[model samples]
Target: MVALHRFVVLTTTLLLTSLAWGETSNPYLPRARLLLEELRYAEAARALDQARAQPGNARDTLLEILELQGVVAGMLQQPAKARTAFQTLLVLAPDYRLKGDYAPRVVTPFFEAKGWVGDKGAALRLEALPTSGADNLLTVQVKPDVLNLGRSVRFHQREAGAGWSEQEQPLTEGKASVARKATRVEWWAELLDERRAVLTSLGSDTSPLGALAPGAISATPAPLPAPAPVSPLPGKQPQVARAPGLPLRTVAYVSLGLAVGAGATGGFLGVRSNQDRARVVGAPVDEAGLTVGLTQREAFALDARARSQARWANILFGVAGAAAIAGGTLWVLGAPVNVSATPAGVVVGGAFP
Candidate 1:
């Protein structure tokens, strides 16, 4: 029984990890492409929707989704949607052009959308400017000034890997501040019309502008001073002194290993509890309509065990998640780390020797 449970735990962990990786790898994009090739535009559109909904899609994946959405909308005679899609694509890639041969119906709307953006001039263009004489404060400016349009600018800001928060200000002011405590900030600005409809956006949720807080620097540990060379007595060798304290990287690895073990144990218990529940529910009934495979007392006992195991499984899962987060944080903050600032966000790299 113990061996079987261990096997189930390992199998469950692998299955869950693979499923998560599959989602991140995007199974819908190729399916959508196939559907599009088959001229099943509606099905293709649905697949594109699924692709858009899936998190962690890369920039190329987003561009493809917009491209397909525009084409699918045009094929379905949804000119407004097609125009909107094309316009968004154009905003992301100003010089983007239709690559493949397309019908006039599909081609016309795209050019019209291009013309619309061209006429807007700098109305859609936004810039984030550091506030003068203010720490951690940023002011947004719209080219050609959008205050006359009676629109509002909404700023979305967050620390890396954190949930976004919105701050809406009149287009006239364009005042928003970054969190002073944040080491790295990701932000985007959206122009909203009177009805809160987004007319144009500076950055998107998937792609945001990243900025490091002023005076915030990556913590790099200083090298330790070498110990004085001890003069060895005749025929005696001096031993090298070991560094004190446990390595942060080793602690991180241990935490991660514990997290995986706990998660697997939880998954196995959950599966076992579900099986027990199924047995209790599907037990054979005798001619008297009473459960025969499991006695009434046995059914009650099994139900209680299932519930108890489920509760413990949930607790273990929670612990696993917390441990995983702690491990990842430690890994990122460990010494000998390299922090690279990119337009999208800050990337931290480290390794144990």
Candidate 2:
């Protein structure tokens, strides 16, 4: 029973540690499905991806899976697969659209235009170079905004390219890729019109300032972004270097353990000494009356003195042991044993032998 309980505890502790590292991938199904119903198809698909990770977590009937899959396929513009997936979803979740709010009808193609900048997912903002004009090649500047990367010119006009959607300008897209890797991308907007275009740049971090030219077509970028600050988690104390050796904590705990051992030893010795003295076998110094021969009263007095001295020694050992153990534990736990300022944060970590 004891061992079984210990096993359970160990498993739970490991599970908790994993959770701390990342959220467990379950319970995302319903939410993902709801997102799909609400037309948040992309996000829903991503959610379902996470949910599908756990083994045997696919409790949904195969038909239900097919249904959601179909919706996702359609939303992603995979018509062939969409047809198949919808067939499944319809069979399994017949009243999905009925149960939840859904769009009344389809509109013009949503994928009419598309672009990405920076990372794959970062959308490039587009605008018809109204200010620049079709006769003009709008020059977009790229800057390295990453911390410590510097404020130097990473790229400039002609660094980024303009073109139609891949479907329309596959050749241009191919050409644009030639130099993309060299620059820090800021935005990617459509140059469809001489005045207005779509932007796929700066991502969520950037301001959604449309083309400098007016008669803009977009609603305010769906959501304005919050200001960018330095590191997010704050007040996390800096760490420091320690004297070369085991972590101070390690030294501390080991010392404490030794001290505890010493304390125990000392206490045992003290009691033994007292017992010996009482028996007169190893009484401390003879008492005052015992000049020539020792008397029982003198022996007893000497024993008591010895015992008192031993007691003090044991108490000292106990205190030292405690300090060592405490110090060692802290070091092992990775707490800064010798925290001090470096600049923004103290640097810890060094070779240990």
Candidate 3:
């Protein structure tokens, strides 16, 4: 009787121990919920595995499992996994929402997944503006939200019969921009996954660039080459008269001189400003003990003068630098020189008009 009683007590203790361990560590649905509530995402995910192992879970139980799994995956920054879980949940329950105030970060992925799965979610739009003028750059903008944060949207140009080929630019962060030779082709965009499969399309902008023939660009025609010099008609010396259009060398030299002068002046002004600052700093210390150094009014005047001179010096330097560069480029390349002759004389000129 004593032995039997002892055996019963031992079994009871063992059973209680097992139950307590299961409550703390087993990945049951209830335990997973508790883990998730405590923000133990990894533990909750592990608990979810246990729940998943059980076959034929109720529809409500499955919904809860998927929602919790998505939440945990999102919290762990596993977007793909979170998206998968949410999509599966959407398949089961078309209208499912988490109870209480969850973060937008976690909730956003759910909505994105919902949009991907069904038609009852947020809508995304694409807007593209092709730049006018000489540059062949295209600017694509997307709204109102980027579906996938880091994934790129492939820009595609449609060909006549060969279908669509990816364009040069990839849109990321809801914007796409690139400089390329413009063509008479239709362009569109698509969001793609890692496998290069199209997830969804961001649509296209079909603004016509006028009715120009394919491969034709509108550009000013080149001026006809100047008539070759006529063979000298026996004995009349060529009377060459040159028309000067702002001598490039002269302009370059003058601009360079001004630049050098302005730079020197700026440097001098900077030194003076530094000197004034030093004086202002020292003035306070020297004047600390009853009557000494610069007066407050004098220090203020010096500071103001220093700032004004510095500002003017910077402006002069910038203007001088720009002028020098422009003039120097013209001088190096040399402008088109045109020459024409009348019966009385020959005239040499720069640019026709």
Candidate 4:
């Protein structure tokens, strides 16, 4: 009897230890977390694995098996396994934001994700944009994959060696044609600034640029030429820069000079006023006539300086206003002004906004 009791006790103890080792959450979880916080991922993962293996462990949503598995797998540099673990984690914890972790992977060659607009659990794929004109006819290709794009594009041709996005691929003899495919219709073409439109369910595809709409952008998949770079961003240049139609477009140079001189006038007024006050205060009352005369002269000088600054400001605005009207007139006559600003000052030499 004694022998049997001892044997039973030994077996029970061993079984308990094994069960503890396999439990989902060890009491030392906090300590393991501390280790993880200190960048001790390996040790923390080992601790977590032991905790998870404890037999007859209570189901703890806060410490799910998948959660522990993901952390362990991530620490092991097994990204594929880690993602599997995380997907399982999502099945258990649906409210969490795993999209941040998976967004980059979604658009890769290996990730074959899909969604459907009409059927439940169905997924859509990438689709190519349609083309009809000579500009896009040969350059555009239909992709077998349907990419749900609400992006719109306008039809425009960029001259070769300038900035055309849709380009001619080198064919047999000197003739080149734009290359395209089902997976990716890789071409770039100049967009009509006025025609560029976005296609969407809201149906905003009616832009003046033309029929091409967008959800995804069609690219050359190559660098555009540096000689004719893309247009600079709108509002990049100052308003004064775009105006070049006045009699005094040349006088923008004067406006810049005027602003600087106005600040100088303020400095001069301050300096002269202080010096004159001292001179009058130090002199005798017997020289009241001279003092008064000197004070009058100083006041007139200050007034003249202020007036000169104001007049310059007026001239600057007046000239700019005239330029705007004249530039518009020239633009209507098919001669546009491309006013440009330079570090030296405003330079009006473009063909215009």
**TM-score top scorer:** 1
lDDT of every predicted structure (CA atoms): 0.68, 0.40, 0.60, 0.39
Better of 2 and 3 by TM-score: 3
**RMSD (Cα, Å) of candidate 3?**
21.5
Model 2: worst 10 consecutive residues (lDDT sum): 106-115
Q: What tens digits encode model 3's per-residue C-alpha lDDT throughout 151-183?
A: 445676543444556653455666776543335
Model 4 misplaced regions, further than 4 Å? 1-25, 61-65, 97-353
Per-residue lDDT of model 1, residues 19-122, tens digit only:
53333367787777667777999999999898877754554556667878998998787878988888877665555766556654466566556545555652
> Whole-model lDDT, candidate 3?
0.60
The best-first sequence of candidates by lDDT reads 1, 3, 2, 4
Task: By TM-score, rank the candidates, best first.
Answer: 1, 3, 4, 2
lDDT of 2 by residue, 1-353 (tens): 99999889766755664443333334665566556656787887777666544333321323344445554754565655555444333322332332222211110011111001111222212222223332222233322221111111111222235322221121132121112222223333222211111112322223322232223345457777888966534655545555644466566666767777777777777776656554454223335312224454454455456656566766767676676667656556544334455546555454432
- Candidate 3 residues lying further than 4 Å off, grouped into runs, are 1-27, 119-353
Candidate 3 least-lDDT 10 residues: 283-292
Error of 3 at 54 (Å): 0.7
Please give each candidate's TM-score: 0.37, 0.21, 0.28, 0.21
Model 4 weakest 10-residue run by lDDT:
109-118
